[model samples]
Target chain A: EDQVTQSPEALRLQEGESSSLNCSYTVSGLRGLFWYRQDPGKGPEFLFTLYSAGEEKEKERLKATLTKKESFLHITAPKPEDSATYLCAVLRISEGGSNYKLTFGKGTLLTVNP
Target chain B: GAGVSQSPSNKVTEKGKDVELRCDPISGHTALYWYRQSLGQGLEFLIYFQGNSAPDKSGLPSDRFSAERTGGSVSTLTIQRTQQEDSAVYLCASTSGPSYNEQFFGPGTRLTVL
Candidate 1:
């Protein structure tokens, strides 16, 4: 069974504080790993897609790194506007080598206080 | 360009009633997906549609849940005999081609079953 787990269910960080969120996964075959940001009352926004280990992608203050077993979303000097639930998801390759379903973690809620 | 869009930002219905939620994927996008997010739970994959292929309904929780994509553009998710447990945010997303691409999401429809 493919599973995704995210740690630090909730984090409170002061403005300009840097922190990292973790997303661990166990899958038969990993096709891709995705990160998203979701605000209250809204759907998730696309962040990054990591296809292989040792891969990294960045946007503004957000950086995402991937490994064979896990992924990390690092926030650098986050601002109040950066507070949101960070979600991690994985696409697993099925026996037929074709699958579109994404298994997601519970997500990490970050509260950046101004 | 307009991203994926869902109708009826909010829906409130009584138990035993039926409801339909709609999704319009980004123009030219051939793949569409639906997911559910319950309180304190991770996003759950509900369905996937790619081009003219049969949808992947394995993620649907029950037979009461059904979805269809018309013209490979607009999709609708229908839930029959709504239950209190069915209350959650139904999110819609789309991708250009395959699962390896980043999915663009809509604002989601907040479904409340009374």
Candidate 2:
């Protein structure tokens, strides 16, 4: 069965602190990995998509790197406003040829205290 | 252009009542998706619609849940005989295509069942 797991269900950091969140996956075929940031009372916001191992993508203070079996989201000098739940989803391409659905992991709740 | 948008940002209903949530995909996006998010859980894929092809409804939790996309642009998710357990945030997202893995999400509709 395809499954995605995220670590450290909750993390607290001081303003300006840097940290990394982990997302591990076990799937039939890895099509793509996605990262999203969700704020309270709102839906998730797209962050990055990693398609292959050794791939990396960045936006502002966030950087995402992918490996064969897992991915990491690194936050650099995060501020209080940057606090949000980070979600990771895996796109598993099934043998049936239709692989558009995303399997998401429990997100990492991040709180940046000023 | 504006991103995906969902209507009825908040819905409060009694158990056994039915509700419909709507989603308008981003202009030109070919893939639209529906998901459910409980308080602290990750987004749960509900359905996917791509162009004129048959939708992938494997992610839907039960038969009581149904959705439809008209003109390949706007989608609606209907939950019948809602239960207290059905209370959750319904999120909608859109992407250019399957290869475009990046999905833009809209402000979710929070459903409260009494």
Candidate 3:
């Protein structure tokens, strides 16, 4: 069975603090891994997609790195505005062929206190 | 260009009542998806539609849930005989194609069942 798990269900960081959120996955095949930021009462906003191990993508203060079994979202000197639930999802295939559906992990709720 | 959009940002209904949620994909996106998010859970994939091909309804939880995409642009998800457990945020997203992992999400519709 394909599954995604995120650790530290909730994390509180002071402004300018740096931390990392983890997303581990067990799937048949690794197609792609995605990261999203979701604010209160709003849908998730796309962040980055990591397709292969050793691949990394960065945007402003956020950087995402991927491995064979898990992905890490590293926040460098995060601010209050960066406080949001970070979701990790993976795209993999089943016997039916390409599984376009995303198997999402319970998101990591992040709070950056100013 | 406008991103994916969902109608009725909020919907309140009784448990036994039926409801329909709509999604309009981006102008040129070829893949549209529907998902459900509960209070403390991750996004649950509901369905996927790609161009003129048959929708992947494998993720749908039950037979009471159904969806349709017309003209390969707008999609609607209908929940019959809704239950209190059905109260959730319905999110819609779209991507260029199956191989594209980057998906654009809309501000979800918050469904409240009384």
Candidate 4:
């Protein structure tokens, strides 16, 4: 079974503080690693996709890096508006042949206090 | 709508009642997916539909969970005899065609069983 685990179930950061969220995964033939941000009652917003190890992608104050077994989302000098849950997911082939599905982590709840 | 949209953003129901959640994917997109997420858990894949291909129902948790995509456009997820354990946010997403592309997500339907 493909599995994804995120670290530090919750985090509280003062405005301007920087930190990183971790996502570890175990899958058979990784197709992609995805990052999403979800607010209180809204759907998840797509953030980035890292296809290969050593691949990195950045948007505004967030930077995502991936390795063989894990991925990290780095936030720098975040603002209160950046506070939200960060989700990590992986896409891989299912045991059912030619089929694939996304396995997501529980996600890290980020609170950026101004 | 430009992005995926779901109906009945919030639902509160009795444990024995059945519920149907709806999703409208982006026009021209050929892949759609359904997922379930408990309060603090990761997303659990439920089902998937792609263009002209057999729908993948491997992630469905039980026989009570079923989904259908009518005419290759909108999709519906039905959960019968709901249990308290079934309370969660049901999310829907879609991609253009391949499984590797970024999947756009809907706001999700928050289901609460009383």
TM-score rank order: 1, 3, 4, 2
In candidate 4, position B87 carries an lDDT of: 95
Return the clash pairs for model 3, or none: none
lDDT of 3 by residue, A24-110 (tens): 999877789999999998878989999999999999999999999999999999999999999999987756885554799999999
For residues B1-114, write the lDDT of model 1, one tens digit per residue.
Answer: 787899999999999999999999999999999999999999998999988887888889999999999999999999999999999999999999986788889999999999
Question: Where is model 4 more than 4 Å wrong at Cα?
Answer: none
Model 2, span A9-91: residue lDDT tens = 99999999999999999987788899989888888888998999999999999999999999999999999999999999998
Put down candidate 3 lDDT per residue, B1-104, tens digits, no spaces: 89889998999999889999999989989999999999889899889888898888888999999999999899999999899999999999998978355888
TM-scores of the candidates are: 0.97, 0.95, 0.97, 0.96
- Per-residue accuracy of model 1 over A65-92 as CA lDDT, tens digit each: 9999999999999999999999999987
| Model 2 complex DockQ against the native | 0.71
| lDDT values for all models | 0.93, 0.90, 0.91, 0.93
To one decimal place, how large is model 4's interface RMSD in Å?
0.9
Q: Over 4 Å off in model 2, which ranges?
A: none
TM-score of 1: 0.97
lDDT of 4 by residue, A1-114 (tens): 677999989999999999999999999899999999999888889999999999999999999999999999999999999999999999887776688778889999999999
Number of clashing pairs per prediction, in order = 0, 0, 0, 0
What is candidate 3's local distance difference test score? 0.91
| Order by DockQ, highest first | 4, 1, 2, 3
Q: What is the DockQ for all candidates, taken in turn? A: 0.82, 0.71, 0.69, 0.83
Taking chain A of model 1 alone, its TM-score versus the true chain A equals: 0.96
